[model samples]
Target: MHNFEEATSAFAKASDAISLKVNFPRTKHSAMGLKPYLTKTVWVLSVISLLTDIASEMLYPVMPLYLKSIGFSVVLIGILEGVAEAVAGLSKGYFGKFSDHSGRRAPFIRLGYSLSALSKPMMAMMVYPLWIFFARTIDRLGKGIRTGARDALLSDEATHATKGRVFGFHRSMDTAGAAIGPLLALWYLYAHPGAYRPLFLLAFIPGVLAILLSLSLKDRQPKPSGKRQLPALFSFLHYWKDSPPAYRKLLTGLLLFTLCNSSDVFLLLKVKQAGLTDTAMIGIYIFYNLVYALAAYPLGILADRLGVRKVFTGGLLIFAVVYAGMTVDGGGAWYGLLFFLYGLYAAATEGISKAWISNITDKADTATAIGTYTGFQSICTMLASSLAGWIWYRQGANTVFAVTTAGVMGVWIYFLVVLIPEQQKSPGQGG
Candidate 1:
């Protein structure tokens, strides 16, 4: 019995040592600085996003104008945006769970991007608002399919220590594409007036490239353990019940914060409200993208060092201040500042939130947790947008801003009392 016990202990130690050797230096430690930046998986996925967003954003910035030109009412536009976003959010959780169950990520990603690519030319050919609605819905569906799967793949490939950097780099690349997409659209619009169709068709080229790039991605299947074999479609409410109270508290705080975050359309509307021309509004959006692209990675690195919860809380506070400023200031330059600050907020929270959720959940359920978090946030965003729209139509812009300000204050109080203590107890819970 002693001999058997000794042998078992020896084998366990040997297995651990082997794993350490194989996975050690998981992130390269090259002298070239940038060479050690991200795992090959993250780089490939980032490139895919870069191409995909370039295609998607080509139409996105001017989508409202396109809808208006086609005679869609503002109410319809709001409904379309809200529904599309809600669908995307809702799908992420289910599709993510599906991927987890099937033990495949790459195929889902391919399907998603392919669907999005197909939507581009269809959008160009739309003769009616309904066609635009279908195109946008399909496009957002594609986004939903890939978002969780791709993030799960990123998590699978990156070392825990470098997860923040990998996610941040991916976001930076994604936002860079966003910045470039609008510029390309602007150039196309300039060179050929009333050639939106041609630009939309042109966007399909990058979408094809994104799909092709996705083909090269390798799927990382989770191990076939007993824990993983259980029913995959678990309720997030039940899942949270077993989680540390800190995680639940953090999520509650996040829900509060997002309720005020609302949609970017409101920001564009605010720009117009501040007296910017349509063209200048697009230009301001371009400016926002540029700032978002530049700041995403650095802010991610900062989050890694200073902690995600702190960075996220600070981001919420910044957003409150920006909304307050937008309320009081009507100058065109103030619009620019608002957009720029909004970009900063995006840089701070987008990737960091995903990283935080991953930290809170088990590895097997990472995708599910991501989906749940996003879904919760999206539901809040939908409600906020609805309220904002009502405020705009009835009370006015001041009411909208005031309501947003109140929402942010609610977020502040929730986090200070609940999330902060939870985070303190689990210092390194989420990466």
Candidate 2:
């Protein structure tokens, strides 16, 4: 018995030594000196996202179809989409703040990913439309929890000079997953007609894989004392109150722009209205994601060379043009062009906008600023989506497009006349 106990002790010590070796933090020099393509943390997280997005997009492209199949109305679809987005936005801010307070990102990340993974399989069991709604909400809840923590981890891992490149690369990988996901769903749909449950079950596999990959990530060390404390839940009120007039004006301009930018479901509906079949719509969407994935990194590089605001404004202008084109009588080809340009607009602004926000804020409060910005934008989107639905129901799709175009034009005028001059004088001018 004594010999057996000794053997068990020896095995425990051996296991401890192996864990220590495997979990040792990489040297700062090693992390810093990594090749752009071979950065360990970035690559690991990218793979995590790649797998998770594959799961996410599988459901994303088919969600509306499922709703329609179950006899949901357009208004109901808009509400669901808006609620999902709002929940995600609100949760992004809250979970980001929670992560900052905890001084640990990994646990939240693991929990979030695990929750999302579980939610996907549960989608298969959803019978009623309300059950599906609950499933979607749970899925979005996981997204909200993961997004902020993952982004904060990315920022912590990157050097300032290469932040654009790092984030751009990550975004590209994410969109590439999006590009593949829809195609995968299309194939599955074709293979087994009306078998969305099997697809949902298949989604669980990738999500689980992503969570397993996340377990390998090393958490950031806690920041030293003398840093600013995290603010309270209502901190945004104080932040806006204390911010400079220029900052206030910029936020206002952003809000004005977002108020017009409704849910992308409207665009999908437009494709349907324009006489394309469901399979054709998915094919067009796949093309749009291809454009988005291909263009995002190049646009980020351009933002680094030119300026984020300039690239962002150009995107807004493109949006204005696209909306105007949508207002005009157009065929299926025009809808395709509109979707492609929409992808371009997304590539121009998505990561760059966050980068710009990071540049403007204090380093200690980086997560807070990002959360606040996202929260504000989400509120605007919620309003815009609801209004778009109403406008489409009452006035017409053309009128909704016309109104959105006008809002985009207004943003352009504001940026040109007001924000540009103030931006030039700011400490971190240009990209």
Give the Cα error of residue 5 in candidate 1, in Å.
42
lDDT of candidates 1 onward, in order: 0.75, 0.74
The C-alpha TM-scores of every prediction are 0.83, 0.82
Best by lDDT: 1
Error of 2 at 54 (Å): 1.3
Model 2 lDDT per residue over 342-370, tens place: 88898887777666655555444456556
| Whole-model lDDT, model 1 | 0.75
Clashing pairs in 1: 359-430
Backbone clash total for model 1 is: 1
Considering every candidate listed, which one attains the maximal TM-score? 1
- Model 1 segments more than 4 A misplaced: 1-37, 70-75, 126-132, 222-244, 419-431
- State the TM-score for model 2: 0.82
